[model samples]
Target: MIRGDLHELNRISWNAATVRHNSHKQDQAGFLRSGGSTLFPEEIELLGEIRGKEVLHLLCNSGQDTLSIAKLGAKVTGVDISDEAIDFARKLSSDSGIVGSFERSDVYPWLEAAIAAGRQFDVVFCSYGALCWLSDLAHWMRDVAAVLKPGGRFVCMEFHPVAMIFDEEGVPKYDYQMPEPLHWDTGISDYVGDSGGALAVSGAENVSEPFVNPNPCAEFPYSVSGIIGAVLDAGLELRIFREHLFSNGWKPYRRMAELPGRRWTMPEGMPKIPLMYGLVAVKS
Candidate 1:
């Protein structure tokens, strides 16, 4: 059960992420990596070429992926709670001459308005660390259903909740460091920095801005079943769901044997585990 105090903490988390997006253009760019089969690109491609399609992006951070879609000839509107990220996305859009719309609002409110107006789109897209921040999964799914046209697609590529269970040592465990989930909390017992625990990217010195969260919300573990349940509950028919251990996008899991593109496999005796999932569903 979500405690009442969490509302304040959630706001702080959004504010901190906004601060980071505004200050860390370079860092964000690096994360995007532009060009190649990163998570965003790979996920987008999995949805098939989006050329000339209309896409609505929920929790679109900094609009990098949104803009990328727009470049592919899809009319895209990216939404997020971070005013700073929206501002930067707008600037990036203008600089690149990509026709993309951006909305600075909480997903719930924006989705409510869209539903009330009976607005819909061809594709609803969300990705990367997006789903966990949401407080209500059912409502989020409802919003996706509300905004989708008949036969429209809903696509998401998120860090697997299984990943959230791992520690810096790569062991699986849970018990957040604080009472409630903090903004940066990965649902793990400890902090793992940006790139696992090995690389440290914190504050302005290490990143664009210091990531600070006064209140961290809880991260409910999402297994494949959990995710599929949300999509089905949202009134979508499951089309394709792909779980993989290797993705050129994240780069960290590149060396796994089960993954494509690399001749290397997991260490000779390493345990085989799933790190993430990519899913696509259709509104019927």
Candidate 2:
């Protein structure tokens, strides 16, 4: 992996270690709002059925999706760098009566260990908001490729880089097309919240440095071509890839009436670019 990528991985590790329990609890509400509704179920449905299939989830913050997949009869194991998130995920599994396993470790090392132990899965699943934290796509892809059994699938549904450019303000000034080189710095931003909105935390209420990480996680933007290339490099062949204007498992803000329940589309006459993309790739 590249030097910058290693730094980013370390940052994520640190963030996972330091993410405040209270803040994480608040964040879990957001995850349920977004993932529970659209991102999680959509990916699960797109994967068809995973009865008795072994699944691996990467960057599985808090493990809601992992547990959800487990509820569908997949023997699920989730790996995340954040200790607090993994703990909450374990609790969620227990509370929900979903049998699953979670591990706190960085992706590369975790996959290496899993491979060494002869671990393989029928599916490797990750989702939106997860990939942006990584610095190197190639290394990440290789790790996802390493622990998969032959014919196993790798599936991901992520917020398009295009969508990421628009912050809570909905400003379009940032470049949405060019994916940049990954870099890291020491800072924290609350991207999701109910009352205060993105990155706005009152001093009295907010935890000091609620999310801690050793590096700045770079948001690497990739075009459809870029995403396709990564999967191919990982010894996976594309089976299904779809870009959608709206996401059913998402709630961007309070005023987004166009996306109420299962609908994911921009208002009429508004620009119709896709907000997210889903991919289903099978091991070759």
* Model 1 C-alpha lDDT per residue in residues 140-180, reported as the tens digit of each score: 89788889999899988776666555554555556422234
lDDT leader:
2
Candidate 1 clashing pairs, residues 3+ apart or interchain:
9-215, 24-208, 38-249, 39-249, 181-216, 181-217, 182-216, 203-210, 257-265
lDDT of 2 by residue, 1-284 (tens): 44455544555644644354335234343444343422344676677789899988998877766776776678989988766778778776666556789998767777778878988889998886677666667878887887888998998988777765665545564565564644446533443332222222111135334444444545465666667888898888889988877754444433343544444455554576677788998887
TM-score of every candidate:
0.75, 0.76
Give the lDDT of residue 4 in candidate 1: 30
